[model samples]
Target: MSETIRRHPEAATLMSYAAGTLCEPLAAVVTAHLSMCEDCRHEVEDLELIGAGLLGSLAPAVGPAIRIPKRPLECEALTDAPVVERRRPDHLPAPIAQVYGLGFDTIPWKRLGPGVWHHRLELSAGVEGDLRLLKIGPGREMPDHGHGGSELTLVLDGAYADETGEYRRGDLQDADEDVEHRPVADKIVGCVCLIASERPARFKSIVGKLLQPWTGM
Candidate 1:
């Protein structure tokens, strides 16, 4: 790997996730990574062990026997092979192979330009403005635009920047309508991001509508 984007090691995020301390978008990044990185999976298990140890030392407390659920396929799919690979939906980071593989490719990702493209993913059908993936491609830049809804992005393989700053893997960029951005990805290797948008793009024009279909806005 060229190492264009600096990945904040899974250790930090895993620990936070195990402790239930990370925010939603950030946790999603960690969960997305854990789907690929065995090291992080072990780290989360270690944290669970530590927690169990702590619980063992504590006095027994009364609580409901709630059935904690497991993510769809861990033991069979992810844990078996153990090596992360780039994804086809714009060759996402090795960690996000599951995310791309699960259902991203099935959706129609429309191109905005030579290098720019995106697709609107269904997070919750009932929710009017639900979280959706705004997939960006290598080295392309979005126009100077603002969000009418909230936007949360986790950098998977590459990185992007705006008037705010740069976002790398495991780096979460939370943007509100107040945020106006024109992000440019690295030209050579390009980048892929898992962007959950609360609102649609504010650039309402012929070109904007073309971009809108990809976002389902």
Candidate 2:
């Protein structure tokens, strides 16, 4: 039996993901969350099966369907070297590690603030939403903020707590416009999370707002 996951994506969100309609970055975070949560993974599989059944019932188009040519895989811009076999860190998910040549320890992190660092991941140009990895030092609090649309966070390591609850490794947090809370990293080992936001965070403090553009939050 799959272990019960404390946190899970909403049924609608899982349906959207299974339907392949979610934005690229958001989809990536959902994919990572599925990797760690067997319950959610089963939910997703069920949703996919339902979707497949529904699609099979749709009427076929009378006219010839348009076909788009496929492009070659080109991820060289994401790293210094071309794709090659490299063992990924046990802490990092395969969905995330495959994008970059470097392991988690070697990722080129950009300092965002005191005890905070981030590394942006590149999706295709014009893709909606944004994906990034955030590492917060022990006892540090993330900016007090509200979401513009929806935000998805998956804990890859350690833990953090907010108004909702405490989230440990493999936990997934889904926040929409109605939610607003500041998360504090666990005081002992801190936390590392994968984040997908539809829009930049709306920080409450003036200082945070001033730093938003620079930090690309």
Candidate 3:
């Protein structure tokens, strides 16, 4: 079970998703999980209802019925296209290859170093902060570096471990500034995760500085 997964899901993200206050990429991941985890979906919906109810309870004499401007939609489509036929057989188990359309369009995969795949998602809609996806191959560990901001991970496929045990699909990790873990992708199948962080990675290894142009990226 992914229950023992380290860290905690960002309460803000959860609340935002519930209130429909997040962008497409994060919302897409949450929606996929909601398709399986009714609890989270309901939680989000409940938050939405609460927000609506609060607005409704406001002074009715305040304003007129606002018309939504169609051509002026606040959100933009995702830039990174996901083409891999990835599978997640845990939890609700989704064929991620097909469902990415719920969020991403397929694009050619980038070979970021050996066995590392990176896809950048352009932010749209109610999104906040810098978010990206990092795909690591089996037995590979990212260069040891400390974080500059809050880092959150949602494991979509395979497993990985830090000082903690393995994390499978549906595992969510929130790495704060105080926590520094050199997580290594399990030597089984690589690990794919949705990582949303506040700042760029700060290199801690000499090799990290040497590869700063590549690593800091």
Q: Each candidate's lDDT (Cα)?
A: 0.55, 0.76, 0.57
How many steric overlaps are in each model, in order? 2, 0, 4
RMSD (Cα, Å) of model 1: 7.5
lDDT by residue (1-217, candidate 2, tens digit) is: 2434588877778877877777777777888777667777667767767776787844432211111111133544555565444353656766566554446676788899899999988767666677889999999998889988889998877899999999988888989888999999999999999999988789998878988989878
TM-scores for all predictions: 0.54, 0.84, 0.64
Q: Which residue pairs overlap in candidate 2's backbone?
A: none
Off by over 4 Å in 2: 1-4, 57-88
Segments of candidate 1 deviating more than 4 angstroms: 1-109, 130-138, 204-206
Better of 1 and 3 by TM-score: 3
Residue pairs with clashing backbones, model 3: 18-44, 81-105, 81-106, 81-107
What count of clashes does model 1 give? 2
Q: Residue 83 deviation, candidate 2, in Å?
A: 10
lDDT of 3 by residue, 95-188 (tens): 2323333222243456777787877545555545555567899999977766776666677667888865667766766566777777789798
Instruction: Please give the range of 10 consecutive residues that has the lowest summed lDDT in model 3.
Output: 62-71
* Candidate whose TM-score is highest: 2
